[model samples]
Target: MRVKDFIWLSGLLTVISLPLSAAENDWPVYGGDNLHQRHSKLTQINKSNVTGLIEAWEFDTGVNDTFQATPVVQDGVMYVSLPFNDVIALDAATGKQLWRYQHDLDKDYPICCGSANRGVAVSNGMVFTGTIDARLIALDAKTGKKRWDHRVIGENTGISEDASKLEDTELGSVSGTSGAGINMAPMIYQDTVIIGITGVGYGLHLDAVDSDSPLGTVVGIAGKYGRRGFMAGYDIHTGEQKWQFDTIKSENWEGNFVTKTADGVELPRNITNEKAALQENADAWRYGGASAWSTPVIDPYTGILHFGTGNPSPQMEGSSRPGDNLYSSSLLALDASSGDYRWHYQQVPHDLWGYDVASPPVLFDITIRGQPVPAIGQAGKTGWFYVHDRRNGNFLYKSEAFVPQKNMFSLPSAEGTIIYPGVMGGANWSPVSVDARRRLVFIPGIHWPVEYKLHQQAASEGKDAVRYSSMSPINTPEKHGLLTAIDLDSGKIVWQVKTENPLIGGVLSTASGLVFTGEGSGELMAFDADSGEKRWSGKTDAGVNAPPITYRIDGKQYIAVAVGGNRLFGFKTGQKIKVWRLP
Candidate 1:
């Protein structure tokens, strides 16, 4: 098919496949939309049909780990991602592999975090995703042939000054890795694909650099071509650079900007470039806090793009960059066209602890406080759920429950003073589901009190700071975790199921009004989306780290998940993706 014709047909199919209010037959993109709600309005597989649902077929991408991907469906094509950073597009109806694409990995698996990819994006005839090695590639939707690829991280792009300086005839020297290649899928909007990055070098225990850790980075790309990060964009049909937005220097930072290293090296400012969208908002590029880690959602009506900024680097400590780190770990509402900050809400101000607001924010209209309002919710690593009015980021009657934390981010919380609902949070990458009709945000929340310590990060000479990062206690006195159902509007607890570990996998909501999640003991559970009562449960090999996705082929509903041994939770390399039918 011609490019123009393909796009036209694809768009029409997208609209038609949308099951009016909700459809059971189609599962597309991560979280089911730019909104990432992960909810299906289709109720055919309800608490009843769900029992009769059978697994018709299963295709293993043979990924070594990270089943975090939610398959993207387009015109009966199912695109799924797996651990080891690979993507496969399959025939949605028969599970027949249509095409498989793999990125040549450099194999520097950052041990602290697993080398697993979240998933990919499909829009305008392209399949897009990032690599653990940091390349953002765009592939042909039908052929899986690499159309183009961009290196976002490795040594230096624009963000960090590298150990080796490149005297760019004009710009002089640029540092950091070649650029931290992408591990997550780029957010695909109409013509632009927005992406974020991760670096493993910010903090270290000196257990000696393990076999895994590599540098981290974030990127943005175009839909058609992988023009590269910074302000890279191209025509949706032709891989041509249309614009760029590069970071500005420190002197240009609008607000107080401070970046600290583990060894404590003070870096220079940036120069504005037309490639990135930050030239106009150059200061935004400089200021600290809340670096974006999760894919963003767009307000289809208002053109406001919502993304969660990651925790300030140097994971644990936050003594260096103070004040409400403008955008770090905050929900940044920006004008989609210009990348202008609309409004901001800092979940953890001057975040000393490693509280990255990296979870995808779910955008949906909800009735809150007895009034229906458009809302956006961010699930924090600190185990707190902050639901806000998407229009202005106003707090929607705190969803926090009394919990415990010890001197987190340097704030002395009196045990249960400001207890968060769950430490891993109301939602993590395991996407949350909301049934608009039911008016509830179905979340499999984590319950635990995360403790912190001052880990000193030093490179060679005096490059160090009082940075803060948090880790689950190796051996502690207190331990807790829980799964919760929340009313998006009133912020009331609909129901909560207690878990044995620090909140295992994610939750899946179906139009059939069922909420599915796994436990530490490796069980896939289904419950009434409205009441949170268990209807059925199935066991897996190990705890599920990834969430479950449901799709229908030949009119049969099959739920899929990744079961693996996560090092943090003491699960070995037991990684396997599993699909389930009602039986």
Candidate 2:
């Protein structure tokens, strides 16, 4: 064979061998594998016997806070993270604690928002977790003792300078991302542990003024507040920072100030004013706030990692920062070995709305325009599931709207503009699961509408000009959750199921022709993957706001999830990791 042909053959073999060597028994990675399919090959708990599945075991992590962890199972041990960054390893078959690692946060630490931890990553006998205090720690898998700890970000003041006196101002809750932390499950690839930061886009969140007023606003202050968010790779063995990729583009951060998106969607932007402001705020990228809130997926064969970026700094306020904030609110591909950018597809340029590409990207092969292509898909806060060419970041097609859409790109007005799928998005940081066999992707969505109204800072004794701003919220008649199944070939919704509350965690699919997800009301339901028919469900004590994972140990298939409620959403909270199996 020719030299080029030999090299091509070797690359193809490496990609194909991954699935064969992965073995369907363990869920070793965050999305179950490099593909982020979140689909398992275990069929012992098939749809036919799904109704017979019952709670097999339950373990309390000893903390009653927002538990959003998806447990990682390997061998017979299940490694999970709890509130406050604590971790525990339990026996997969029986809920017996093997070891526990307790993390103590600094008393003066400033947490930007809730204390929910997404999950943990286990690799080469070490367990990794990112803390709410902005630190990455490694612990021995067997004994749960601290191996090493590294401070990922600087001390977060949790409040900005200008908003310091507004702490007691009944106007709204202003949060600072000064020392923002991590909420995503650290990803392990090759010899590195990859993770990102959160809370960089600091803003004010106001609860509905009162019970009579359910439409509160989120105010975005324009001046510098948080630092530029980044994703970094670390040496898995020694806890050393290897490389880092800042989400916000510093150089050429200001683009052409285009009036529309690359996909041809018109934007509500004042181009002339923005262009003039660019020269004065040229250094805005230094404190740009596009956080890395979701875990990244790596394409093992090509060594490319795919992940989403958060909203830009001073989210909702575009007065200070100008130009298309290059990397925020976009899908990015990076070299796995070196944290170098490969390509980026910005969903919303100069994002004034908090429309973060928060959901993790899922990779799968799809037949686009009658041609099979490697693709990456992300369900956006904009209420669309976008598919793109994995190699070059080209927009292929987008799925139909899964949630309601009204006043989509409308700027916040003094009268409170109503918008669907507001700040929370049709899909939030919740992960999307893909079933390559059926060419269908499952999305857990929220249908909340927001009342976006701008509030102006009055010209006081020293200030001459009054600044105008608006807060975001859903101004809907009813709030609900949507579990949607979208067909890749048609970009159409196969079927959708609505629930009582907005879905927060994520979805899980199995080879047994089933898809499982949790609801804020504490019900874990299984549905027919193809038809979206509900098969069975069991109610937990608290909200099941986390992803579910299925793994086999001793030839028995088991499903597990964290059952603590979400604080931001006001769900009932607990401290339980519940596992179910067929009786």
lDDT of 1 by residue, 1-583 (tens): 7553442232432432233333346666667754677776655567766656555566656655545666676677778776766778887767788888876776553322457677788887888877666667789889889888776544533333222211121212222232244555566556877666554213332222221321111111111111112323344454444443322113432333333311132322221222233443333333232334566777655777777755553333333332333455567777666666578776654344455666778876655344456678876665556778787887765564423333333432223222243234435555566666566776665545443322233343444322222233332334445667777666777787665655545667876788887765666678877676778776666666667777766655677766664444444334555676654
* Residue range with the least summed lDDT across 10 consecutive positions in model 2: 207-216
Evaluated with lDDT, which candidate comes out highest? 2
- Model 1 spans with C-alpha error above 4 angstroms: 1-24, 49-54, 107-113, 157-179, 206-235, 238-289, 368-371, 402-427, 454-472, 475-480, 572-575
TM-score of each model, in listed order: 0.75, 0.94
Taking the tens digit of each residue's C-alpha lDDT, what string does model 2 give over 232-281?
A: 99999887899999998879988778899877889999988998888888
| lDDT of all predictions | 0.55, 0.83
Candidate 2 CA-lDDT value: 0.83
